[model samples]
Target: MSDVFEKVMDLAKRRGFIWPTSECYGAVAGFIDYGPLGAMMKRRVENIWRDFYVIQEGCYEIECPTIAQEAVFIASGHVKGFSDKMCQCPHCKEFLRADHVAEAGGIKNPSTMKNEELAAAIASCTCAACEEVLGTVEVFNFNLMFQTTIGPGSQRVGYLRPETAQGMFVDFSRLLRFYRDKLPFGAVQIGKAYRNEISPRQGMIRLREFTQAEAEIFVHPDEKNHHPSFKRYADYTMPLLTYVQQEKCEEAVPMSMQEAVDKGVIANEYLAYYVALTHHLLVTIGIKPGRLRFRQHLPDERAHYATDCWDAEIRSERFGWVETVGLADRTDYDLKAHAQQSGTPMTVFIQYDEPKKVARRRIIPNMSVLGKQYRNKAKAIFEALANATPTAEGADVEADGEKIHIPADLFEVRDEIVDIRGEDIVPHVIEPSYGIDRMCYAVLEQSYDEDTADGEARTVMRFPPNVAPIQVAVFPLMTRDELDTIAHEIARSLHKAGILAEYDDSGAIGRRYRRQDEIGTPFAITVDYDTKDDQTVTIRDRDSMKQVRIAIDKLPSTVCALLDGSLKFTSLES
Candidate 1:
């Protein structure tokens, strides 16, 4: 077992965050139940994500159904291609992730290997389960989607959507019309995504069903370089892992967004802009700077649909530098595929400023004449003509699969005056997808430490205010009625003001503070007898163990300002 992971798991259960599901009957793998604290923490993290990508970024947040029809996956190429290789343990008959097992045994790029090669790799290896030599290992594809029947009959096949971006793709036309035919627009969906792992041995880092916050930004293919808000984050510095740097085995180099794009560490301004945003959001949400890096996805590891992909990987004691977020440039492949399969025009019409007159050859169909000649098929001929490009006709026309033998008497072929106003184009998508479960674990693991305070080793979680499960804990000095009353009142005030505050009075003041600190409450407000005299409370900084006095009336704003970093506890009275 990973020792650090085991420690965090115990801390999570004891502190009211996350625990295995159905513990009474026997715990289940790949499923975890969030406790009161965990649920609150998850919501808080998602809300902050909304602020960054949805609100500040000027995108729409949509809620879509979790169960999608099989056609959706077929159109999105998941039904055919979304698969992971699997191998079973011979002795125990337990299945394991094929590539992971091969890679752990020194096969460099197991994902790119063929089934025969995979089998060969496993043959020379011993199963981790029973240490028995794997014999004639079989490598087979396993679809990771969790399938379900939609209705009464088991006929209709449905699946838990593997991603949130597909809903956005399928809803593109409605959104386009709603936005009044805008060229560049974005849509986001934050919800659950599922992948049935064969074995989820890595604690919270891997889950069968997990929360995913994803953004899909659609733009004209040629216009991806000219992001309007590119300048806002151009100067922001980040740890960039350029493709070239990897070739030299160099460490991730710190550089500005401008340099990252200019140096080709990031593909373009649009991609760089979002990568910078991801970095900012991670840091703002309590991930330490040194523990985070942006790694370029090696070619074999990139999603099949992505042209360029990078991930925001965070370092954890349990899993070293795991991928918590993915930033990918999925160029118009999805839309094109859907458009072709569904027989719907997916391109947006980009209108020109002024209509242009162009001379082009046309099959001038006489409606009155052709209508009489082929009365029923006249409209069909016109449709075929409209869809047929000049080159397709080649001075002859095929109307509705009927070869139209053009004769001078039947129709006239000549250059005609026409107005061309706009052209249709498929919009390319850039996506930033995040895994909330992995990130939550990264936060807990990175912030965890055991420090000796007064000759006692104390475990504490140092979460930042924005994403911390509990922001502050309101503690009364003693269990006396008056102190408890004041503490309860103060806690109520904080709750009303949207602060997560806890009212604890049963334990000693020091013990209470320690308890709150253990769960990563940044500030603790202790109501004492001094509050009765001066009506001022003592606010203690959890990390520094320093205390200051503040008026009771100023508590809300003072705490609010401190939480946002606009004011410091040292500068303020508390």
Candidate 2:
């Protein structure tokens, strides 16, 4: 780990941000427990995400169970495809991800390699634990899903969802009805997703169980190039590292959403719009824009369902560039898979502006001649023949898993002109899947800073005002009866105004300010002697340490405006 990562983690654990789970009984590697402040900050991040996707974009939010039936995943291809290459260490018997080991051993893009290729790459690699050379170690695919039984015994199989996108796909019918059978609509889910990692060494970056906030936007397959809200992000420009540039070892270039689509860099407007939205959302949640870029997925690395994909990568001291959000154009893959597996029609009816007369072919079965040839099976053959399109010679149909051939005399084909008003189509999906845990870690790493304050070295987390866990910290200069009472009253008033305020009067005033600074509280209110005499107190900004005296009556509104970025600290009267 980098020194900065270690320092930030130490602060996180020391202060009640996050810590290992089951610490007293030897904590697990891939599990963590968030402290009070950490939980608050995580919720703030989620709420901000909700505001962007659900409220602003008008996507309906839905919650689904973490564990789903085996069929749910079988249809989604998770049972067969959701896996990682693993190789066991010869000396220590430790199972490690083969791709990670290959990458560490100077192999590039190890994840796209087949098992045999990965085994060859791991042949010369040494075990991270025992330091023994792998020497032709056997690499095998290991399924990552955590399997379980839904009801009793092992009769009904179930597994923890590896991604939240499946639930929205499974509930497509209901969501379609909710949106009144619209062509374009979105459903979002924010919940826990699980993956049984072989070896999770990146602390919070790689977890067995983590939170996910995903939005699955269903749109007409033909309308991908024209999203209704594309104008909102059409002119917005951001750094994009296209696959073509990546292959040539080129850097990301700033490109507008419209230009990316027009140049065929991004597949369509829907995909580019979400990529731009993801950028804005990450920046809003305190991720530094300079440290963020959207990288297009290489063809070999893209998911099986996606035609085009981009990952919002954030630069980190320890993990170079980590993928926090993935935006992909999953074109009707999920719905079609489920529909075929469940024997349900997952389609929407789109009405044409004007009804048109079209030529259609009709097949008529001659049952009277079929009854003599096959007595009991004639009706079945006739029914099957009615649905099959026959060539000039004959028609072939399947009945009870048996392919039956119908001679030209047994069926007749006729062409007819019919008026068609509408057609049913399977909608494509544009998904923005977020790794919430990675995002939280990114927020922490990017917000960490150390500098001199009051001629003393101090550590601080420079969280954005709206994204801070506590918006303001209330303090009394001393631990006196009158000071404590006034501070409590001020805290209560701020709370009533929906501002998260913490009242502190325990230690020295300087120490209290340092505590709030470390926790990323943007403002600190001190109720001192002046407040008792003149009904006014001092408010200190966390970033600049500048103080401004304001009446107690104006504290809530002032703090609200400051937190919302309407009022600037430098503009306040001193």
Candidate 3:
């Protein structure tokens, strides 16, 4: 781990941000427990995501069970394709991801290699644990889904979902109805997803169970080039690393969403809009803009469902650029796959501006001849034939588990003109999936800073005012009755104003300030003797360490404005 990562993680554990799960016993890898402050910050991140996706973009949010029937994933293609290359160490008998091991052993693009190629590449790799030479290790595919039986019997199969997206896709018909059968709509799911990792080495970055906040926007396939709110981020500029740039080994360049769409770097307006929105969300949640970039997925790197995808990667000191969010254009793949597998029609009816007369050949079954020849089976044959498309010579219809060819004499084709009002089409999905745990870790790492305060080294987490776990900390100048009472009152006022405030009277005022700073509290309110004489208190900014005294009555609004970025601390009168 890098020095910054270690420092941030140490601060996180000591200050109640996050720690290993089941630590009293031997803790397992790939799992963690969020501490109090960590939970609050995570929820705040989720709420901010909801504000952007649900409230601002007008997308409906839904929650589904983490465990789903096997068929759901079978339709989504997770059963056959959601896997990673795995190889077991000969001496240690420990399993590890083959591609990761190959990459660690100086192989380039190991993930795209074939199984044979990967085995050959990782032949010289050593075990990460025992350091035993892995000579000619056998590499095979390992499914990542956590499989289990749903009922008492093992006959019924189920698995924990690897993503929240499949649930949204499975509920497409209901969501389509919820949106009044509209062509353009979205549904968001924020919950836990599980992936059985071969070996999770990264602390919080690669967890077996993690939170995902995903939004699946369904739009007409032909309308992908146009989004109703595309203008919201059309001119928003951000760093983008296209596939061509990656091939050429070039750095990411600043480009507007509009320019990316026009240059075909981004697939469409809908995808570009969401990519820009993801950028805004990451920055809003304390991710440094300078350390964030949107990188397009190379052809071989995209998922089976995604036609075009971009990953929002945050540069961490430990992990160079970790992907926290995926913006993908999954063109009608999910809904279509589910519909075909489940025999359900997942389509949206789009009405035409005007009804038009269309000409087509209609198949009419000859019931009289079919009744004489087959009797009871004749009716089934007629129904099947009526729905079947007729060829030049005949029509093929399945009835009674038998394929019967109806010759031109048995079925009649008529050219008819019919008035068509609308058509049903499977809507394409543009998904923005977020790894919440990774985002939280990134926020902690990026916000970490060390500097001198009052001639002493101070470690602080400079979280954004809105994203901070505690918006303000109320501290008493001293452990005095009057000061404590005033501090409690101020904390209560801030709480009633819907602001998170922590009250501290355990130690000296400086110690309390440092405590809050370690946890990324944006502002600290000190109720001193001046507050007793005049109904005013001093508020210190966490970043600038600047103090401003204002009337106690104006405290709530002042803090609210400051937290909301409507008021600047530097502009405040001291």
Model 3's alpha-carbon lDDT is: 0.91
Order candidates by lDDT, high to low.
Answer: 2, 3, 1
The list of candidate 1 runs beyond 4 A from truth reads: 1-3, 84-141, 367-405
Residue pairs with backbone overlap in model 3: none
lDDT tens digits by residue: candidate 2, 1-574 = 4578898899899999899999999999889999988999999999999999999999989999999999999999999789878899988899888988998899999888888988987899988888889887889988999988877566899999999999999999999999999879999999999999877988799999999999999999999999998999999999999999999999999999999999999999999999999999999998989999999999999998999999999999989999999999999999999999988889999999998899988888777788888788887787788789788889999876789888898878988999899999999999999999999999999999999987999889999998789999999897785998999999999999999999888889999999999999999999999898899999998989989899999999999999988998999953
List model 3 lDDT by residue over 112-207, tens digit each.
889999998888888887888799788998999999997776789999999999999999888998888887999999999999987797899999
Q: Tell me which of candidates 2 and 3 scores higher on lDDT.
A: 2
lDDT (tens digit, per residue) of candidate 1 on 101-216:
88778888988899889998878777877878777878998998989998997799999998888999988889889778987899999999998876787878889989899999
Angstrom error at residue 387, model 1 = 9.8
Please list the C-alpha lDDT of all candidates, in the order they appear: 0.85, 0.92, 0.91
| Candidate 3 segments exceeding 4 Å error | 84-141, 366-369, 376-415
The true-versus-predicted C-alpha distance at residue 545 of model 3, in Å, is 1.6
Q: After superposition, how far is residue 519 of candidate 1 from its true place, in Å?
A: 1.0
What is residue 547's positional error in candidate 1, in angstroms? 0.7
Candidate 2 residue 322 Cα shift, in angstroms, is 0.9
| All candidates: TM-score | 0.87, 0.88, 0.88
